[model samples]
Target: MQHESASAMAGHARQHYQETEQEHISRSQSGFPDFEKDMPSLVNRFSFSLKDNLSSYLGSKNPFYSNVDPQKDYVWLLDNTAYQNRIGRWKAEIVAAYFVKNSGKDLSEVVGYIADKIGMAKDEKVEETIEQRIQPLLDSILPAHAVTIDLQGVDVRLGPSGRDGISTDEIAIPGHGYKDDQVITSQAVKADATTMRTHFASPKGWAVLSDIDDTIKKTLTASPIGILKTTFADEPEPIRGMPELYKHIVQKLDSPPFFYLSASPYNLYPFLRDFRETYYPSGTMILRDASWMNLAGFLSNLTQGTEAYKVDRIEKVHTWFPKRKFICIGDSTQTDPESYGEIYRRHPKWIGAIFIRKVTGVAEMDESTKNDPERFKKAFDDVPRNVWHVFEDPNELYTKVDALVQTAT
Candidate 1:
């Protein structure tokens, strides 16, 4: 009975992975990408088969890939890293990313290890094609806007929606800025895009730059399966006391702009946005490029490249708000501490405080991360202890932030 149960569980997991893959296949067939036309030819298929078989053989022999299982998931995650817009201009530059990802659990990790060992996972990067179309859904929300379409893509130019008769909720970034008088109304709409609008906050005021996974949302990044379950299967759950803390900050700042910066893919933007609207302050979302990889690839990105990715985003934000001081929030799961520290070093005067949520539930970490000291001790060693804080609970964050930003505010 015990053996049977084990087999059943494995089989169920495998089936789920297969079903998910099939669903993606169906979606592609639904005319989104015209996958049939893009399908590889017979010769290409032969070449790919040869490469895949070679990889499988090599992976089976690799000592590090001993746990290769058939039931792993490879997902393509979308990461929207940067969205550049002027304070009162309709023109906006939306920079996004798309890539494959691994479930980072069990067989997925093992396969990722093998894929990396065999050089089959060349970042699993997909090139952007000129024919690919980019569309913004909330154009009607703008009072006056024009889109220039080309074979290459479209550039969205938005003009100011002067406050004459515009409701703040209807415009992406209201000309008047968000005010207590402006309330988000739930109206029946034919397009999901109506819910989305792109606008930048008026600069020069303090803003909060926050991390998504684990810091605000309940992403179990430490566990491979935990990651899959949280990001894929579970309804996004907010970290306890986090919403209240964010509310307090926004209230104190009287509604400063916010930016949710993350390494998570752009595919999750809508998901995270829903959660944000429900519990946190509204702001621009910054995500890294998406990718499809197994667990090994996930770790490779997190360990070898995450710090650079985060630092680059932070620097860009600093460039945009050079004169504005900002609060940085992230979790201790990955390299947030180090990444934020690097940003602080470059712009010491601009970083008001760095908050790292210490993850105590998970015990295991990647070999590279295992060497790092607990919390902000080593990551922000040179920075004043008061400037950066590490805590397990969100309640503790309010006090630490108050100590730092109180006088500045």
Candidate 2:
């Protein structure tokens, strides 16, 4: 019954307004509401009621209407939500005044207006960012180190070394003209470690250093402004299978033997935190510089083209944990291979292995490293055997290292 009555009342009000509008149009054809002269009596009758409803609605939405002392008839229903936004962004005085006057509470008194409006509560949802989420996870395994090896684009042509046709030395045989008196020079040969029987283990005080973009996560080619907006405003999407791997590394491997190294700038902390919260909530992070991108800095990329910022980070890790061995993992698409190779050469005992991700854009590894079992033995130079393995995906490494982590002290 109440719904029916309300419907009837609306219909009657519409009819009355149409009749009044038609009559007003016929008289002057101005199609305007001249409040000062026309409909003075009607205003006197309904103006108070209209003003009251508007004020009531606005007041319930916020406390700003309480301080407004305008005459009941003078009020107009205007949306002030965007006006407040404009006041902060464009600094328009008139728009700001309307928001201030119509709103009872001072704009300055509204704490967490942005977060509140967006429904992002710091304690509940928005607190965990990619950097913060990953930080503790990384910190728990704090002794991480990485080594990237670049093969210097060396060719892997196979066959015997030192041609057979070049004759220089004349030999004097003890038994002249004898059938077994001939002396010949042969090329050096060695066996690959993969075929050799050995007991393997992860060294003490070890951590894993890794590349960021394309190795563990997808790289979004964002500009500086885009990066800033993402860090300070937008959330990030995490890579598949990363959260579980991180948790396993933390809970299984534990702390002081695991860490992360990346070339991404430090300004991306917010995005990092966002990624972590969405996936690995307890992860740890270590970021690089907060400065603008420099073209000159990019020149340090060794083989697979990496950001030069990672070089400093890798060096820093070696300096901080000089005695700790780092099992480095990165993609062939960047300098992970070359840089890690350098690290292995410099500190053989401190670097356990260089695992390269076989990627499309990077240079292909030597065929001998891919095929011959013996050539692999001499490639490590002075480093320990089985310290270099190339993989297509980063996740594959956990399987090989799982035994080491399970038995770790």
Cα lDDT for residue 247, candidate 1: 93
The whole-model C-alpha lDDT of candidate 2 against the native structure comes to: 0.35
Model 1 per-residue lDDT tens digits across residues 222-301: 54444534544456789898999999887776576788988664445556677888988777787643222112223223
How many backbone collisions does model 1 have?
14
Candidate 2 residue lDDT tens string, 1-409: 1121232244334433433222333222222223113211111111122233233333223222222223211111101100012112211010001111122121111223223433454533443442233221111100011111111122111111001100111112111221111122111112110110111112244566766655566543222222222333344554455556656655545433334555553323445535544665222244542111111111111111233345555775565456556667675444456567667777777776676655443222233333333433343456555678776555776775665564333
What overall lDDT, based on C-alpha atoms, would model 1 receive against the true structure? 0.48
Estimated TM-score per prediction? Answer: 0.55, 0.38
For residue 292, give model 2's deviation from the true position in Å. Answer: 3.9
